[model samples]
Target: MLNPSHLHRLFLYGSILLSQVLPLAAQAETPEEIACYNDVQGKVAWNQKGTRTWGEDNARNLCKGVVQRAKRISCFEAGILSHNNWSKAISDCAQTGGEAITAIVPGKQCIYNRGGYALTVQWYNPGLIVFNGGDADDYSKYSTPGTPFRTEKIALGQTSCTDAANRAAVVRIIGQGFLNEGITIAVGTSVGIGTGVLGAIACVGTAGVGCPAAVAGVSVATAGAISAVGLALPEVKEIAYIGVPGSTNYLDFSGTAWNVGISNKVPLSQTRNFAKESAQTVASSIKDFVTGGTPGPRSITFNNQAGYVAEMVVIYQIYKDFGNGTIIPIPVTKSSGQISLGFSKHIDIPVEIANLPISVFINGVGTTKNQILGATVPANFSGNRCFKSFGTIFNPQSSNCN
Candidate 1:
């Protein structure tokens, strides 16, 4: 219905509008893509939904000279200079919507040395720029200063082996990991080895620089030697030595086997040794006195046996009521012996007592039950009073009738 000129003008306007609208509609469909471009300050173009989200070339363009700035800032921070310069650089990075330069990267160091910066800018990404070090294939062989030293365990034995072959074996075992290598050996003061012996033992094969010519058999002396050895072998950072106890002579070969790289000492207890004796003896005089019979000389025979010769003392206590209501403890007898182990000996212990209600207590080696050898004294002595004796390791029995 419109005129030709009006129609032509309308067509031209519609074409221009279509061109602008189509591009805007495509951008509107990918909001993240728009944000990525805006966030990286137009330096990086990103296709958020694509497999390659960011172009490496774009990242390189963004980080062109940032690595050099990061290195200079880091070195300044470590030095005695005022921290304001370093702080300003970090602030600038943050203001640019990039990560703050906190540490000097290894790649940055290489770039600085080569007088150029070839770092990829991941400012919009999560991490710092990393330039390849070119020696990646040999990285495994690089030992950092933080690497820990190796450890080895060695055991020293008891007993002195005077024989050359035996001494060699002992040395071989003691120097398990450090035979050709320089090492420190800590010896206890209790060790009987002399200074000459210790030096001769330590200084073998490749003697380390400043190795002690002699080491006194003392902990302090060994420590001094260790310091000297450490100075000699600069590669060997630290050496730990453990002293073993109960090592007698060079050949006694008795000690715990070393499993771990550290030392463990175990305590040994003393062995047990003791002796005992036992016997039964009739006390006719006391029995006769209790039964109101004629008193006669009462002979007592003790069947004693000893085991494990050890010095020991025996104690005997007799309680009696001598025609009085008050019962009194009487010192009957005391004996001591250097008793032989597993041997039986006969002994005679005679006692003369004039009492009705009586009780005898005997303790041997100062240890045993029924060391209270006799039965309890009767509450009231009306019939004959007699007892059978017994003995044990703690208590020994003797014959006594009085």
Candidate 2:
């Protein structure tokens, strides 16, 4: 309908408007501004110095790049960031300092960290799976059944290996996940298995599994069978370490064998050496406790028959919850429509009159808004001096006679 020259001018004007609007729209969708999106919505975040968000299609493409080539990968390939950001936020956690990042994808680090061990289980789908330290406390066990393979980053700590600081960092990253499964956590050892929930905290063992704090020399498996229904929180925050409180001459080796009698008589130096060995065990438990993870070194006991009584020093830390100033009020109902109070309203009236003769009573009590304040009374009851006594009976300004 217009001349060619006019049409060209209109196209230029439209282009200018689009160029200005597009960037503004993009800015509004920054990572911080983006709301939680669903699986279908396909939103992903990358926290490198700061948060970077991408929509579904773009997020998927970027996730694939990072998972395969990027220095770090977010937990959600295309989902709500709030729902899953533990691992993604710290996948390259080691690079971010000593802090370890927990990934929902169990043993993901182990898979990449332990290149020698072949990965057998496929974690492409979501479910419960053991990430590391399958049936034993050895990283090598990752190559064995019941153990999910992991690379260097995912491998559990090596016993007696001294990397206290790094181990502490990594332990913190996985503490919550391990505790939910009732799996013992330590720098050298970690276990993850299907627990029926994404962030389940307690563990339910298979039937017939049992563990003795100290198994007599015998080659058999032992585990405490706990239910998975609601095992989600570790009851205690930390465990105190008492130096291997057990008999010096009595020794149990992984329920596999026990050497008793004449062989038990080790020189005093060897006895001290054994306690030194336990120091690492104690260290591991302490790390778990300080990091809010389950205690390592499950149990220790002594044989009464043996004349060995060792006094291992114990170390324990108390648990406490410092208030953060968040208060919830309690609400309460009353028997009578009108609540009443009983007190000597007159300052002139002896305080003893109200304190002895009448007692203040409240009927219904419940929280209103994190605070509790409620009372009820019968309409037929006589009004107390505090309510009815006027100027002659009491003066609010008077000081207590007592």
TM-score per candidate, chains pooled: 0.16, 0.19
The candidate that wins on lDDT is: 1
Tell me the tens digit of each residue's lDDT in model 1 across 263-300.
11221231111121022111111122122133223322
lDDT of 2: 0.22
lDDT of 2 by residue, 1-402 (tens): 899999999999999999998885565331211212232132334433234544454443332212111112222332224534534443422232111122232321111111111111122111111122234222121111111112122221111111111111112122222222332223322232211123211122232233111221121112421112211112121111101101222111110001100111322123232223322322222211111122222211111110011111111122234569643322221111221111111111112111122222211222122111222222223422111100100110111112
Instruction: Show the lowest summed lDDT stretch of 10 residues, model 1.
Output: 108-117
Least accurate 10 contiguous residues by lDDT in model 2: 253-262
Residue 12 accuracy (lDDT) in model 2: 100
What is every candidate's alpha-carbon RMSD to the true fold?
29.3, 26.7
In model 1, the Cα lDDT at residue 181 comes to 34
